[model samples]
Target chain A: MKRNAAAFGAGALFAVGLALSGMTRPAKVVGFLDLAGDWDASLAFVMMGAIAVHFVAYRVVLRRPAPLFDVRFHLPTRKDIDLRLVLGAALFGVGWGLGGYCPGPGLVSAAAGSLGAIVFVVGLTAGMLIEQAVARALPRRE
Target chain B: MHDFTPIPALIGGAIIGLAASLLLLTHGKVAGISGLYGSLLRQGTSDRAFRLWFIAGLAAMGMLVRLTWPAAFASAWSASLPVTLLAGLIVGFGTQLGNGCTSGHGVCGLSRLSVRSLVATLTFMGTGFATVFVVRHLLGGAR
Candidate 1:
């Protein structure tokens, strides 16, 4: 119960940061992508700042042997380049270039009651559900 | 390009970094948006109560921000609804196929120095650059 509260608190903080950073706005994203036009390099700075912090913090965390909340770091161990990954990357790029909203920003923007963001989130969630169903239906290879 | 300045951008970046770091510290989970959403889809029941709440809190923050300061929320980008929806569907499919989103892999995963995430991030980013080039120069349709 307490952990849940903490998670919500952390998420709220993240959302607030997204809002303040103008990440929720599609225009900023589009501008960032637009190299010829009046591009906004602000997001780059954001990325840099985030990377710098994570660089230091991750080392500290990894040294602890295990995380505070669990037993291990819980990172993915897969290392394969397949068709699904390539196709997915292409699709994601198309969506981002066209809509200017990725999952994180889309969720944050949806709170603004924008019809576009709402539609995006709904579709995003629906797609996930559909994928799960399809994955379940597939015959087990093992 | 007109009004939003550097101060807000810097402050916002710091805040996001702090929030991400804190989440990592407390929950020991990367603040990857796609993975969180994906988890919600699979796994019927477990220790997911907090994950759902975190998603909800994100929505509420949007509402609060808009209500408190509408001007800061102004955006310049505009596109047809159909286009945006199609784009979103593609992103959804991509996230599933790739096993994560930009936030999941690009930001958090790369930060952790995961080799897979590095490859995925490179692919996505390279694709993004190529997309913009194609859309603006070769195709000359999207805007």
Candidate 2:
């Protein structure tokens, strides 16, 4: 119950931040992506601010042996930069450039009942589902 | 950039960072939206309750903002229906395959000093730049 409450609060705060930063708007997102033409660099500030805060906050919070509500910190262990990561990122970037929405903003905007957001989210879900299917169908290489 | 608004951007970013930090501190989990949402769809996964609550919070907040302050939430991007749909599909697939997006890899993973996240971020940014150039300048997709 406490963990769930924390997650909910965090999500709400995140949504508020995304909207306040103008990230929920597809045009604002694309404006930042538009390098050649008239570019809007506001979102860069958003990234910088977020990184700065998290950079310090993470180190501080991590000093504790365990999370306030959990047994241990659940963090990613992967370090290698593989083909899949690069290709997947490249593909995601193309989509981002094309659509002006990533997962976070996409979800937020979709929640607001924007037609564009809804369409993009549907495609996003379909894409994810398809990827999962493909991954399963492919032979595993351990 | 003439449209640069640093104050709001910084504040908003800080809020996002704070939220991510809170989640980490309390739940010991990275606030990766794509991962959270994807896991909910996958079978045999635990922690469905937290995911549902988190997503619900996001939606409720969004709806609240839309209703309370419409002006502050307006956007300017306008693309064709087909273009938007295709872009959506690509974004969904790419993020899933990549295992993260802006929030996951860009914010949370990068904060952890993950090399994988760094490489992923660079690649996505590069491709995004290239795609925008092609779509807007070359193909005249939209202005």
Q: Which of the numbered candidates is closest to the native, going by highest TM-score?
A: 2
DockQ: which candidate is best? 2
CA lDDT of B39 in candidate 1? 86
Model 2 alpha-carbon miss at residue A141, Å: 1.5
Off by over 4 Å in 1: A139-142, B1-7, B43-45, B136-143
* Model 1 DockQ class: medium
Report the Cα lDDT for residue A52, model 1: 67
Residue lDDT tens for model 2, B18-121: 98999889988888888888877777878788788888889889889889887545666666667778887887778888889998899988899999999999
Q: After the best TM-score superposition of candidate 2, give how far the Cα of residue B132 lies from its true spot, in angstroms.
A: 0.8
Give the root-mean-square deviation of each candidate in angstroms.
2.5, 1.3
Alpha-carbon runs more than 4 Å astray in model 2:
none
Q: Evaluated on chain B only, what is the TM-score of candidate 2?
A: 0.93
Score candidate 2 by lDDT.
Answer: 0.86
The residue pairs found clashing in candidate 2 are none
Q: List per-prediction Cα lDDT, in the order shown.
A: 0.73, 0.86
